[model samples]
Target: MVRREHEGSVLEAGQALRRGEVTSVELAERALAVADELGVYITRFPEHALASARRADREFAAGVDRGPLQGIPLGVKDLIAVAEAPTTAQSTVLDWGQGIDAAVTTRVKEAGGVIVGKTSTMEFGCGVPDRAKPFPIPRNPWDTERWAGGSSSGTASGIAAGMFFAGLGSDTAGSIRMPAAFCGVTGLMPTYGRVSGAGCVPLAHTLDRIGPLARTARDCAALLEVIAEVPFVAPEFTGDLTGLRVGVVREHHFPEDADPALAGVFDETLSLAEGLGATLIEVTLPYWKELTTAVLVTASCEALAHHRAELITRWPDFGVSARGIFAAGALVSGADYVQAQRVRQVVRQELARLFDDVDVIASPVASIGAPLLDDVADEAGQQNAEVFEKITTPYWNGVGNPVLAVPMGKTGDGLPLSLQLAGRLFDEATVLRAGDALQAAR
Candidate 1:
């Protein structure tokens, strides 16, 4: 029964705990065992997780509870600090030592959630997948050989494989959304400043955001209740999408580049939206190319500043991919960086204009479906790093809008296909509501 609960939402898990249908210790051990079996957690800290769960159980036993996440187990990104646990961030540069606790962890503890383990991550939250780090490459539970799509790779894979009900992941570009897409789960990048960033390792302070990835948007919403500064009104799960509007950009935005099955699923998703009374509208953003360029320049410069000391002191300790990318940041001129910021202002203004006409915009989470682990390895030393940047996330990060990646279905080979929906500024509730409707259709 506990194992069955693993595939359900964090809300369901909490219900089981409250009903005494499952013990925290039993659930913690089950999660830890699955983490080991699925290769979801690179660092299995069962002792820490069990102890935390036990504490939570005692609190509940005494009529002290912290809300929805009480006694729930979660895996946090290695980049986020866990007190007395090694914060490796999947970097060869990090020595094996305990790290001080981060603000997010502190909040979770206070909320009565158990930190099960530190999931794997790309060094310092860069998107490239290079095995130069000490930890094993995190595997996609849906298909072990495929890439899990980012710096939050392990967190997505871990949750999808039923290792944890939900987990914390950061987005500097699409770190959170991409992995959520590739892993067949739902993830959210809440409005900027909606959650605190204290204690988590910096990626690009301006662009980085921490959010939750879970099996469903409801689950993600439950986690958001903990991290968000203000109490969130969980969307009235009116699966009815009456009078809802969905905009699709097909040419350059969502092209034939998507895997066939993914394309099909997206089309099917459109039908579902229509059936629920949504009017699908076709739309395009102006100056899309500039949006992409501005994101790169801004993100690179911000990242360079954050890691200046580390890059200089322990340059060789970084994962090869991270080091290579950070080196490019150093080369960017002050003029180019400023120009990028100006471009960002333009992009944001344009996004604001678009949202005025539509409820939400939908697109593929990635141009291509999940790549094989071997493919990521094969391209490690490849030149034209900018090419990789263009092919992946950054634009949304630059614009600072809420992007929700909801698992639509799977590809021909069984890899997941996700549709990304970007909402107006600070409109996470509408995005989650849209996702909730889509998930129910599935």
Candidate 2:
């Protein structure tokens, strides 16, 4: 039995596999063991995973390596369909028979990645922690008592806990970045439409993006190389941010009541970026608050549209938190939806203008670290977690831009704080380059 801690980034694992240091079967078994212990998986397909691993091992032995993800064991959020596994979306309302491989799942499999199982998520990718639901709540690996952010909950917690090297997560209103921030892992939400959302459940058609969460920006780059629709060449890590222009949006992102520890860490990270020769300039986003409001309205209305029939017929089956959120969408007037779209267009144009002046926009991923499970167990906690603690993520979602959340430093309690880098549309390479530089510096 080879130890699992030896496993790290997908690149490192690929190198080790090529060197005969580890087998795909060993990695899959280790991942299953850890996932079972942590309750990170909503479903486990040990047999199917081992079968895939054995095939990956054969391919590697035959010198037919697919890529960095070849032989890597990865998790998929439950909302995404994987052949033969139930796409429960961590809700009782979904039809299990509708499960089919999502486009991203097909890509991962084609790249020789082993599908471990479906991971837990917030019900339909919206809602507070609901103990009433018949699914596991993903706890932050940093502190089991703290809640992992969702609806990419299990993917983030699983990666942070070393259950797998990387996993697919959908970001709409910070599902990927928030959990990645809370769990102390790196997550990327590519520009909307860069990756297909087909076969995966949708929260908001316009806001949803499929991307990877992993240990490092390079690993995410590797994953994106496989899954992205257009050709994406990852930038080389130059170990310094020379010639990079980073716009720091401190005024809007950092509220006056934000944690002093988080602010101090963010300031230190900015200094580090400056030391790397990157020019840092403070920039105020136009109508930042209104843009954020546009995200809420658009996402809520879209979600309501998707679940209207279900909410009408299966109200009891849905989690209370999800039901309330989706139901609130019904109250949104057509005029309000159209007005929100206008705001979105305006915000997008403003961001485009802002990006014309800077290579990337930087902000804190969240205002605070992960809150305790007990603190976010109900509606009040959900409000605190979604609205107060998280401010910057949804704004990017509204503008439909690529954002990468990378760990900057830890809180006084050892929880992770992250920095978000937003890039021009379809310019994920720049955001990732900045993230890679920061991670290397750390």
Candidate 3:
């Protein structure tokens, strides 16, 4: 069985600490021991993390409480800056000159969350691993030969492998959800701009978002409470879905080339949700093809605007895969980017009408499990077209809504299958509530 992050979750660890069953130092030590095992972290902060853990112990002993994430070991995706470490972004082009912590990183520290290290990600959170580069190419915990999905590669796999309680990840097009699905963990992609993006490196400025990845949706909720700088209230996971109108969207989630097991596993998950009193209504997304294309067009153009200078001066400094994407942005016409923006507005209105009938939309995060590392990329860092098609996460990013990906079942090969819950604009509370209940039912 795939051991999930929930086995050593934040809630449980907090409870253990309160009961004097474990110390923060012990937790920090345990987190450090395995940090290097899965090639998860790009940078490690041993002395600093240990000192924070000791302070946590002092605070706890003196009856002081920070928040839900207090004393919890957490990972930060390397694309986000940390004053104590370099923000490598898994590439060689950028220089970290006197790194300052990102806004989100500051919030996490304020909540007493221990920063174990900076985890690995796709180059600038955009492409497949470029093995020719000196950075570590993340390997899956489920099957080492298979890849840990990206561009939030190491964060999700590290959570699944229990390297740390949970971590922060960014999503432009399925970076968070795709990796969570492949690695058998829970990842939340909050509505764009829900969390501050002051210091994190951008992939597509128009499409980028930051969110949490953990073993369960409730854990994600707790993390969100801290990171989003929102009001605090732990989401209830009563496994009760009464009066929950779930929009069942199977339009393109189940593809012709999907794994044979996807249909069965997805059906079983829906049945379980229905059993919990969720009224399922069939629905289809509007302009799925147009929106998908829009995302590509918009992302490429925006990314090109950011990297055009460096790309011209030092093309070889970038990974082969990232180079191609940045260069493609140059080919996108101004009209194309504007048209994609127009499409975003129309989809937002259409989804509003759709949301009037359903509380949340449900679908498969992906149709297949993680592909082998050999298939992740070639010498030029090009991924297989068919492999990329399996991910169903980009649509939500384009629509700019809060979505959650949670493990529903396993494939025939024991790789995880995942379910997605998408909610109305800025309605992350409802999305997390539904995700927690569905995960609890499963």
> Which 10 residues in a row give candidate 3 its minimum summed lDDT?
1-10
Segments of candidate 3 deviating more than 4 angstroms: 1-6, 97-99, 229-233, 378-380
Residue range 39-62, candidate 3, lDDT tens digits? 788888889899989999899999
Encode model 2's per-residue lDDT on 1-442: one tens digit a residue.
1124634898898898999998999999988777355447888889989999999999988889798888899999988889968798888898663447889888999999998988888888976678877888778777888888877998988888888889999999999999999888899999888898888998999999999999999999999999888668888878778989999987766776666698889989999999998999889887887988888899889999999998889889988888888888888999999999999999888888998899998999888888887777555434454444454678888888899999999888888899999999999999999999889998
> What RMSD, rounded to one decimal, does every model reach?
2.6, 2.2, 1.6
Count of residue pairs whose backbone atoms collide, per candidate: 0, 0, 0
Candidate 2 matches the true fold with a TM-score of 0.96
Residue 237 displacement (Å), model 2:
1.8
Candidate 3, residue 197: how far the Cα is off, in Å: 0.8
Per-residue lDDT for 239 in model 1? Answer: 88
Q: What TM-score, computed on C-alpha atoms, does each candidate reach?
A: 0.93, 0.96, 0.97
By TM-score, the best candidate is 3
- Model 1 residue pairs with clashes: none
Residue ranges of candidate 2 with Cα displaced over 4 Å = 1-7, 35-37, 97-99, 377-382, 385-391
Candidate 3 backbone clash number: 0
Model 2: lDDT to the true structure = 0.86
